[model samples]
Target: MSNKHTTLRKPVLLTSLPLGVMSFLLPIYSKKLGMNAVEITGLFSILSLILIITRPIIGKFTDSFGRKPILIVSCILFAASYFIFSIATTSVLIYAARIFQGIATATMTISTYSIISDTTKENNFSKAFGRIHSYKSTGSLYGCIIASIILSFMTFTQGWKMLFLIFSILSIYSVIEVIKNIPESKKIVTVKCDINKNKSRNTMKLLIIVFMTCISSSILGPVFMIYMQDKFTNNILLLAYAFFPALISESLLSKRIGAFSDKCGYRYSMIFGILICAIISIITPSANSILILAILWILSTLGGVLYNVSEKNIYTDMIGESCVGVMYSIYSIVCDFGLMIGPLVGGILYDNVSHQAPFYLSGFFMVIVAILILILIKKDSICRVD
Candidate 1:
């Protein structure tokens, strides 16, 4: 194992606690702020728009300026965004925070993954992503428990704000970690600002697959808690509990799944994973009790771990280490696009149609992506062997 791979865990672990806290709390907190589902989705869509505009630029700058400085700046901005979130009084202020967070997110995503790509060997890339993801998932699991504990003692908005404050503190620590722990990677040719040198036939196809898969996966984002609210109960602790199984599954299974991809081929692992997840998405809507819901989503979470590890592995390999920031920027754009639009569409469907409609639509899209992946497999373009 690369020394940097072990070192990489520190920053990923530190940064993810805040992100994990936010991910579990955001929708629930936004609802407490009296925002509707469409408003929440719109918030994310706007955030994605900001990222779409900025990530490529951040990537370009990181590629030329070096990853560490950009990464440090991102951490600073991320901490500031959480400060903004903690004191946000209006939905408009939340919008401002999201914009800053979006920019921070773009820089962080491209720089961090690019660094991982630079430091880790190509052969170990799958395991690297999986391990990093496991760390984040584990952090998120603990974050949910932390949020639940806070909520137990305080009001919903107050608990959420406290979580934001916790995030702000952790992000500041993340900045220190970046400067002290992470060594700078290769200083690439600085003047090639075109940002278009990395695109290939395979990359476009991969991006399309990624976009579809992200849309399907994120389609429930705006309305999942609402669905849970409608079905089981509206308790925040219960919702926090609901996130537990998925996070645990991701933490435990990601490394093993990555190994599976290494041996079985990325294509096989991804296809099987997606099919399981897609089929489970269909069944999840029918879950009438917490036991059934947990079981179904836990399975979906396992599938998620499988597909996600393989996807990042293949995507990183195809893009190459040198072009990490630029290509991942493009990758982030498509992913953010999917994540943004899915929620908007899902929120609309959830409000207008039945609550179950979003899940159905989401499952349908996953099936489409699964079919798309199948076709690519037939063409021998999507699946690659190391």
Candidate 2:
């Protein structure tokens, strides 16, 4: 990679470090802070709702106003929200912090993706995206390891708050890197949104797939920590182990899969990924040993890495370069809707049915998503093949 690519990749990695840390620790800490399942679900739902509503507007603005300004403002807000979260001791404060965090989180991901799509060519897009995922995974791994150590020594509240403070400072550094090193793409692709545009239709399809996949995938988010905490007694270690597979998948597997997709086709890759995840889900909950659970988590992470890479490529291929921001925004909104619903539904289902219900439901949806992808590929055969 060139210097520019290196520069772009740095901020992405830095920003994701904190995101990765918080992704697991936040909810677990929420429980430590005395919030119940209902409150936890409500907080995430609010975040998802805000992201669903705000992503499109942010994307559209990125087209006109440029990515840098949006990124700067958003990163500041993102970092600041961590401080808010650190100080939040009550359910109401947690909810408010998450809301702000949700809004701020949107820009980092959307703008970074838009920047990559804008800067690179079609042939390089998958590789670039893979690199981004790799960095993201690396950050996640580092965060999990660090968090695990921190939690071992400190109370959950102390560890979580300190983590936020450290990550917030890192996020600020990322902003500085973005301003100084990452240059804006000179080629601006203006979107001509028309009812008849094939791109628009494709964007809609991509959004639908994102929503379905996210809903299925996010079902384990809220309760996974609690389940591990109850079963293993050392929640931090289980959580750390659970995410280790994801780190490997993101850092190593996703890039290879992405490169393979460029030659073999994204549709097949995506379908294969979904099938693997569905199978894992069907069997994972029955694991009688920690070893089995770890193996299953790795399998699931591999599947997710494959699906995420292929799905992102499909979106980029369908929407083209000019409308990347808009396409991703729409994609984010739909995915957020799924994310919002997943925890709420999962919590309810676990309460009514069984703790394993969420995994079973996730598996079922993954299978459905595979079938849906096949239908989509057949319907849009020419575009997909090309």
Across 243-300, the per-residue lDDT of candidate 1 in tens digits comes to: 6777788888777777666667776678888988888888887777887887887889
- Global local distance difference test of model 1: 0.78
Candidate 2 per-residue lDDT, tens place, 20-86, comes to 6666666677898899977876776777788888898888777667778777777787678777877
Runs of candidate 1 exceeding 4 Å displacement: 21-24, 27-41, 155-158, 187-197, 377-386
Among residues 3 or more apart in sequence or in different chains, the pairs in candidate 2 whose N, CA or C atoms overlap within 3 Å are: none
Question: Over the full model, what C-alpha lDDT does candidate 2 score relative to the true structure?
Answer: 0.74
Model 2: per-residue Cα lDDT at residue 201:
58
Highest TM-score against the true fold, candidate: 1
Kindly give the stretch of ten consecutive residues in candidate 1 with the minimal lDDT sum.
377-386
Per-candidate clashes, comma-separated = 0, 0
CA displacement after TM-score superposition, residue 349 of candidate 2 (Å): 3.1
Give the root-mean-square deviation of each candidate in angstroms: 3.1, 3.3
